[model samples]
Target chain A: MWYHIDPSSGTPIYRQLVEQVQQAVASGVLRAGDRLPSVRDLAVELAVNPNTVAKAYQELERAGVIETPRGKGSFIADRDHTVTEEERLRQFIEAADKLVADAYRLRIGSERAAALFAERLAEAERRRSGE
Target chain B: MSDVAIRLAGLTKRYGEKVALSAVEMVVPTGSFSALLGPNGAGKTTLIRCLTGMIRPDGGAGTVLGVPVGPGYPPTALKSRIGYVAQTQALPERMTAQELIGLCRGVQPRWNDAIVKRYLDLFALPMKQVVRQMSGGMKSQLALTLVMGGQPELLILDEPTMGLDPKNRHQYLQVLLADSIETGCTVLLSSHDLHQIERLADRATILVGGRVAVSGAIDDLKADEKRVRIAGAVEEAVVLGVEGVRRAVKEPGGWLLFVSGASEGLVERLRGLPGVTGVQVFSQSLEEIFLSYA
Candidate 1:
């Protein structure tokens, strides 16, 4: 699975991981039953502590976004078994609100913000389709 | 067994009236990975030397692994149980990496060749190359391998990653952290590299002018000290009114505030204030913190 992180963002590293994984699941880039890399491997790739990656994974598991099995690795949870659409939408909107507030504080206009987000979504979709 | 692997109580060291260290108290917990960080001449090296029995402290009494540490008490047993790698390269010029490893194994009572070979491979050190001909990074790796091969219960390293390239530094840090975890060895390392310390150290002690300016778990230290930048004139009262702020300073165009505890919600509150253009939560880098203390 592909992962992207923006170090410039003030969000903590673990939160970044959590957000990226959630986005991947929401966009269908990470399908259910796809085994994710182990916490150690992800930490090495990201040059972060394994404990931080573990914390992210634990939170994802708690939210039913991922599943862990003994002696096996974590995998994306079945969508039907995960949170309801209402709850997922609520989380997405909360994140969007934070991003919008930050953009506004930086003097980004509403039109520019909306256009930039749409461009990013299209780019992501293009990449997924190419894959 | 005491929880502390090393303890210093009011330890003082002076070099001909130039006070190197003054009445410093520190406790290194058993099996904990601790990093002592300071700039040059901050007495980090002096403190490490005293702990390793290389030099005597002018005052104070303490113990290493339950053995009394003072004039009459030799740290013989403690020395044997602790492996030390000095910051400077100290490998014999004529000896090859493998030969030095062999020599160290002969001198140490409890040597493990299997571990030595594993580390040799892990670090990708050329076993046949002469120590004198080895690159700076290779020599550092060999020195670390020699110490780690002894499998001491306590590992004391003085800037293990010094003089290494970025890749070598990362590799060395990984080995150090892995060794600490697998062996449960108590480690006391002195380094100026903040990013590496952030990654590897479980706890850190910041030494400024021979005294601990701050010391605690890495996360706790970061969480307790918040870096806040606000875009307008900030009153002392306004800053003090912030629940977690411990210190505040107004820069030319912004205010830098240090919060003593978690200030997760302070950003939102600050954003709603008039004339506030930004509210950022930041953790001071080790270099920044050191400079501020200086």
Candidate 2:
């Protein structure tokens, strides 16, 4: 899957990659054994320094979100063994907080927010199954 | 012995009575892309000239690629491995792109014909087109091909994309960034294009009014500088006195404060104040930071 980067965004590029890759794995868009793009290839595609991509991959590898198999490349790690339950929940909240804050700004309440989020999850599922 | 590709210490330059660069200093690490940013008359050109040993600094001392620089323009042997793309660079009007490449091949000791040919085709420049008839974009691509072909240890570019359309400017920046990545060449690019600098440069040194005003990693600098919008009213006097707060201006329904960092404690203090409903932090773009300094 292709990744998008906003060079002008306030978040650092490496941090953005961590979040994106985590979300992709969580959503099952990327599964265990799925290979991630090589550092040089991703950097050229994103038009950023290769060092930045390397840093992101290193962080992912450290967190056990992805592992680099010798001579092959980085691949998504098995979710159950990747991170402790507490750490996985922390990552989930970090991503969820942003979504909640956006909806809160529009005066959207929790029940409606839940419904909206469900629809989004269904939409994501549909796209993934090639419907 | 040092890995720094360029270093300036209290470098000063004067033109008759007027000063161009005044006690300016900066260091560009080897193999790093450093953007030399400034507005017009900010001594960008003067600094580049000094680094390349094309002009003598009236004071201070510096080095480029480990070689001592200048009581005056450096001799050919010292400058042989440096590639400089002058802001007002021009090609021979009667010379075709191929013929000019041939001419450079004869003089440049490190010339690589393969690179020249590769970039020429990459830019889709007509090899048979006379230099005089080429557009600004084509001419710059031509100049850059020759420069990169020589495989300089240090590549100094001054406003390399001065007069080009949006597409050409973007493409030129992409090629430049990619080349620097592939070769690990030490690059010091002088440009007013702050966005491009933010994209390609790991470090930035901003010159203002003949002095180096701000210099550091672009990421670190951007992190340290922030703009925040607080909903509801704010006492301008009270906000002004807050620690690390630089400036505060009253806007509709709120006050926009320019603060130096993303300190959570600062946000908590603002939230605790009367008439403050919410606070939103914004990271200042490179252009915004440039304008503020300039």
Candidate 3:
């Protein structure tokens, strides 16, 4: 998997990398047990400092989103067990805030926006289950 | 080992009546990748030269890797451990890359031919081609290879990526980054590419008018300096009234406020002001921060 980082952004590079991995996991783009690129490899790939990549990986490991056994590379942790209900809800709310604000700007009514979200959620569930 | 790799205090230098460096104070922590940034004639090269022991500062003091470096202080004890790559070097024009590598290895206490060969192969630099026949990019890579082969504990790069294209530039930085990671080597690189530096450096010291304008961890620097957009017809005086707001510029619908020392309360204060319909805070990029000082 490829991770993209915006060097010019005000967000710290490590935070950006951490957020990317979280987003990828939330979207099912990265499944549990999927191996993450080693810290050195990812840093070289992004042309960033290796310590920045290590910091991101360290944060992810602390959050239980990824795990690295000795002599083994990092892998996405089993999300269902690793993430608490409260943590999952917080992540959902964070994603929903953007959609909600965007809908309000576009003048879409709450009912229609909620219906659209439900449809998308059902579609995502269907796709995941089918796989 | 001391935590500091380089320290400068009141380091002053003069070049024929022109002041190149004036009482400059800067520090590079051990194992940190640092970028020394400034415009042309901003004393960046002068400072690098001072740190590398190429020249002595007329006044003040400098130390590299725990050894005092300045006038009257010989660099013999420190020179072997530090790698200095200038923007241009007078490589013997007639020598092939292989021969130059052999020559550099013979003088250095530590030389890793494998490291040189690895980069040579990675960059596809011709080992048999003499320096006179190599292109600018190839020669640049060769210079870097020679420096890295010595396994210096400190790498001082002065615009090391001046001539390479984007792909080559990335490759060159990778080698440096990897070496730093594996060996815990400290790097003090001076470059004009803030975009690349932003990604590669953990700390940055922006010099202006031979003075240290801003020097700190990049994250803290970005956090402290911010731009805020306040909606509606806000008066400049009203925005300036806020404690942290430094300058207020008129915008189409409202005003843009340049703020320094932006604490959490600063944003809240901006939102509470009258006539403020909305307030959005943005962290300034490294380039913007440098321009502010310039």
Instruction: Give the number of the best model, judged by TM-score.
Output: 3
- The top-ranked prediction according to lDDT is 3
Clashes of each: 0, 0, 0
DockQ scores for all predicted structures? 0.25, 0.45, 0.70
Candidate 2 lDDT, tens digit per residue, B156-218? 998898777877776777677778878878889888777667766778999998999789888
- The TM-scores, one per candidate, come to 0.79, 0.87, 0.91
Mark the regions of model 3 whose C-alpha exceeds 4 Å error after superposition. A69-72, B231-241, B252-254, B274-277
lDDT of each: 0.78, 0.83, 0.87
Q: What docking grade applies to model 2? A: acceptable
lDDT of 1 by residue, B136-239 (tens): 88888888888888888889899887778998787777777666766878889888776666655667788888887777776566656667878876566876
TM-score for the first chain in candidate 2 comes to: 0.72
What is the TM-score (0 to 1) of candidate 2?
A: 0.87
